[model samples]
Target: MRWNAEFMSPSGRVPFIKCGAFVVSELEPIVQFAANKGVTLCSRLSTEEKAEMRAYMSLITNVLVNAELYISWLDEETFNAVTKVRNSSVYPWPLGWLQTRAKRNAVAKRLKALNWHDKTLDQVLADVEQCCNSLSQRLGDRDYFFGTPTELDALVFGHVFTIITTRLPCRKLAETVKQNKSLVALAQRVDEQYFKRP
Candidate 1:
């Protein structure tokens, strides 16, 4: 089935998928970065921390997968809006306004059953730090989980890229990741591999 009128077109899905693929490809680098930085692993996490990590991972994975699937169904206007966000050179007001409105309406309806609320930047950063520390520990010296690409890698990469590359408040995570040589190398490798010009 095609995307709804509110959603963007198949072409719009290209950037979204490309972004996701880039993140998926960077999983190993992030793990390596964590190892070098002495982050704690899942096995080492306190029971509460481990639970939080699992929940955080699950939330991120769901967002990435849903975004991938949702983009596949977008119509023209929705597609254009997403492209505008990615390009950023455009005047972002109308586009951002429209996108935010659409997203709020949709999220409000879809998440009505859940106790959802906006989080402060500090809250988000704290959560991110907690998760990064946990995952980094589990990733010691591993090139990839299960020795290959996995959905977890994709989710982590996507969040890291968006949080790091954008002017969003969460860009500090990118800075933290960069502090580790391994993570920086991994991000560079992924950029060269997926985001480089043909």
Candidate 2:
């Protein structure tokens, strides 16, 4: 299921994982599930460090994710030019139209709840830039958030990579991300070390 993956997800979101007979939705839950299975990344972190990581992760989820949703759904130009077409591409006619409308409405509601629905596109981009700035400060000169690869690195890489590479009607988001050299460097490092492996 390409566009239909959300239908199978317990939370009606994409990027859910199925391990054997069990299903895990969302990144944090999936990471916790993996940790429970002995696949640990932040095991060496101190309790305080772990708490800080969680806070940063929450910031990313609240800021970056909301910004992405706003761009894809709330921005009229992007919604009309990219999101609507891509979202409905896998379906035919009336169902596609129905699904796209529903998804857009759901995203709008979510953003509204987060107080992001009323923000202008410039405001959304500013939020993304501030998010990138915070992440960059945390990272500083370290190659990773904790001086070692962890779930935080993976999470940051996933969002930053998508923002940079994705074709969008508005280039401001990508441009904003690119303005942060440290974050871009971190993304490049992850891409080189992990994704480049054969």
Candidate 3:
């Protein structure tokens, strides 16, 4: 289940290339959830929008699966080290006996520039909400999109999970998702089934 990290870095690939393996590993439970919801892959919408959503959703799901596989391969020490580095501004490891502060600063500046987005956090959240709401409206009271749980459901579910779990600035959207009973339930189910194991 090896993945190309460079390919996974892009926003478009993040959901699918990184997340697809996770979905596959937890396919049984996910399928059960979909069955309960009566979601079908073949949606009722016309050609264009349906196709577009399906493509986006598929990419997201693939990424989630890949991420799951990556995490599973990490040992406890590695996991803790990664967690610490993510939580703290300071580097978790020694940079070498004579590393200079200026060098570190230069690296940080480069990384920040690489991650700079044109949109603000609020703007990003708004965009996510718009997509969710549009899909939800299309979904109506049905448990899932289309007739059964398709790639879209898994991708949407994984995105909600990442939103809640990560320290990204757009956490407001994640909090909002928590307020959605259906979405939260889906996230919980997916996490419990796929991510609960050591």
Candidate 4:
């Protein structure tokens, strides 16, 4: 699995990439393209499984991703302590500070547009709990979301692992994740099987 990977800055946008100068950005189209090309990421997904994967992806993106953004930007303590340093870790001092502030403002505006900026931390975390619970129930006793290992597992991993590992002063979301034992083990299992970097 030799590949080039770039760490795109956190700018309140979706991840995207260039394939031989043909740019593809959004997640759904990228996934469909891969599936159409019989790529490894989606080669094994059946029609039903693909639908399930898309459903889960929507849930995670809408619920977990937004909750993460709200916490990282709107929550005062997390912004000052964790998000600020993490989002700016790559750039040098003054530039890093400026970049972080710009990113914070962008995320704040996006959240406001989504009507999420005004919610209290508790409200946001309550949504996190519901989302996690729904996902956890869907994943009970299974190694992956839709049976065998697939892209859905990978997408789910991104959020659960991120919440667990993020160094936020506010840990409500992480705590909710911990309350679900299956998610913890699912992340650990996937890390061992798919993401080992030795």
Clashing pairs in 2: none
For residues 14-92, write the lDDT of model 1, one tens digit per residue: 2221233343123434554555557534444457754654565676544433332233223234335554354333336
RMSD of 2: 1.2
> How well does each candidate superpose onto the true structure, as a TM-score?
0.46, 0.96, 0.45, 0.83
Best-matching candidate per TM-score: 2
Q: Please give the ranking of all candidate structures by lDDT, highest first, separated by commas.
A: 2, 4, 3, 1
**lDDT per residue (tens digit) for residues 39-84 in model 2:** 9899999999999999999999999999999989988899999999
- Candidate 4 lDDT over 1-198, as tens digits, reads 211122341322355655775566566666766766677665567788778778888988888888989987878888888878776777788988998888788788878888888988888888888888888899988987777777778877877887898767887879987898888889999999878999
Which residue window of length 10 is worst by lDDT in model 4?
Answer: 1-10
Predicted structure 2: lDDT? 0.91
Task: Write one digit per residue (lDDT tens) for candidate 3, span 1-198.
Answer: 323332344331332322343432243345445555686454456688577665666544443332322232222343344433442333334542123344334434543454422334444445555555665666566666664655666667766777677653323555655666666566676677667988
User: How well does candidate 1 score on lDDT at residue 12?
Assistant: 27
Q: Rate residue 192 of model 4 by lDDT.
A: 90
Which is the leading candidate under lDDT?
2
lDDT of model number 3: 0.49
Q: What does the lDDT read for residue 127 in candidate 3?
A: 50
**Candidate 3 runs further than 4 Å off:** 1-84, 87-116, 166-170, 189-198
lDDT at 133, model 1: 59
Q: Which candidate order results from sorting by TM-score in descending order? A: 2, 4, 1, 3
